[model samples]
Target: MAAPEPSSPAPDLPLLDEHRIAIDAPRDRVWAGLCRWSDTLGIGDRHPLGLLLGTQPRRGFERVELVPERVLGFAGRHRFSRYRLTFELAEITPVRTQVTARSNAEFPRLRGRAYHALVVGSGAHVVSVRRMLNSIRRESLKD
Candidate 1:
């Protein structure tokens, strides 16, 4: 099925992070890794639950946009937070590509604010995002 409409924050949401990596593979190969959930949890944008809306916690993000090798975006929210993650690709060379992962999110209410504090304020989120980008780079380079 086609991905849902492009996803973005409500403008009031904060910019969580913007991480970039240069990969040896071409954009197409890198794009494949963007679509992979296990391979890149940072870009988990294709799970069925991501699109299904309910009060139940969601394990993944629904695809909000796809532009071939240029962009892949998704948004999903659980009880504590609502967030959007986007991977933007740029061709650096015939055999190389640059991928940037940008995240925007908001944690509302008292509990949500606390959840954000524990997760985002602890530096864990940044570390995990970097690790995820590296994982994608490694996965894409594999033969």
Candidate 2:
């Protein structure tokens, strides 16, 4: 895995951010599930934020790197602003996976920053992301 880049100003938020969760699933299963989420959720061309904002889908792709049962990285871009959302994973047990997602972008001023922050930092957005990932993990375990 590559070292994390320093956090930068998110155009929508005042602070760069990181969010993480642990799932009870084998690393391979977890990794595979994440790779397939775009098609599974019918968001193949849509930026995640677009879906969150109730806009139509746009073009984007999830970039996934696999390192067996030890590590995995999942990243996708927000189409309009090109913000990157990245998730890094570490296996803590045979069936436990720890994952962190970081949000980063370059915003010029406070208004833009606040706007982006509001959208990204909202509780509803956070919960939606968590639920989506958890659902992916659950589905992956079934195969």
Candidate 3:
């Protein structure tokens, strides 16, 4: 069967956003560290949303969708959206790994666009998601 369609409109924001970094450590070491839920815990400090949502404590995986060297998907909560965020490992080479996050919530529209336009943007949400992605990358590297 084909995948189901999304209910909401394609987020007016960038969806498949990504960042690539060359960690000082080897890919396996980085992958090992990245794979752990503990590594992700409290890493929100770098995220722009983190500043607003605060740090999330380490919680064990309630469900494990996929696990292996090449890909890993799981459900967990973050500070802003209380939804399951999936991290997909796209590429894992000896030198580096590529990962992406996918989630859709009205929080961005609420706290981000709607709030900003009415209060800050005049009618548009000006929050920079690129900055958020960069923050995630920085936090990921610290481990």
Candidate 4:
């Protein structure tokens, strides 16, 4: 799959959450850290959601796009929702990079709306995503 363009709209899916962080590390290092951390979380390129999706290695996410040290993306679906998460990296200076994590998702039907309220409205998704971004910053800055 291809990574969705950053400036482009997410089509029918709405923007669920977005977070940005500036890391005091090289682009390459941040890219590596992103891969490693996402992999360890078992959500890298695996379809680990369930049988409705596929029995893959990681969690519910599958890496749908990659662009070396620049862009990384993932998409997955369950009974209630279809979603995408994209991480874009831009070099601010030789020693710094800005990382933005964006999530777009569509929740269908009554059940799906309830699920959305439970996760998004409760702010759990924001906390989790922010923590993940921070973890990448920490890991990337490591020696």
RMSD of 1: 4.6
Where's the lowest-lDDT run of ten residues in candidate 1? Answer: 49-58
Which parts of model 1 have CA positions greater than 4 angstroms off? 7-12, 37-57
Task: Estimate TM-scores for all models.
Answer: 0.78, 0.59, 0.39, 0.80
Local accuracy by lDDT, each model: 0.74, 0.55, 0.42, 0.78
Per-residue accuracy of model 3 over 28-140 as CA lDDT, tens digit each: 55446555542443343356655554423234222334455444433333433333334555445555566555543333545545443453345221233334334545655
State the lDDT of candidate 2 residue by residue for 1-143, as single tens digits.
Answer: 55333332223442356777788887777777765663554354445655763322233333344454444433333423334455566788988887666555544467546665676667665775677667766766676
Estimate, for each residue in 1-143, the C-alpha lDDT of model 4 and write its tens digit: 45535322233568887899999988999998898877755443534446544423227666767898988877767777788788999999998999999899988899889988998889998998999899999889777
Q: Candidate 3, which segments miss by more than 4 Å at Cα?
A: 1-26, 37-64, 74-82, 107-143
Q: Between candidates 1 and 3, which one is better according to TM-score? A: 1
lDDT value for model 4: 0.78
lDDT of 1 by residue, 1-143 (tens): 46566544343468988999999999888878766743334222446544443322244556677777788777767777888877898999978999898988888899888978988999888997798789878777767
Worst 10 residues of 3 by lDDT: 1-10
lDDT rank order: 4, 1, 2, 3
On lDDT, the leading prediction is 4
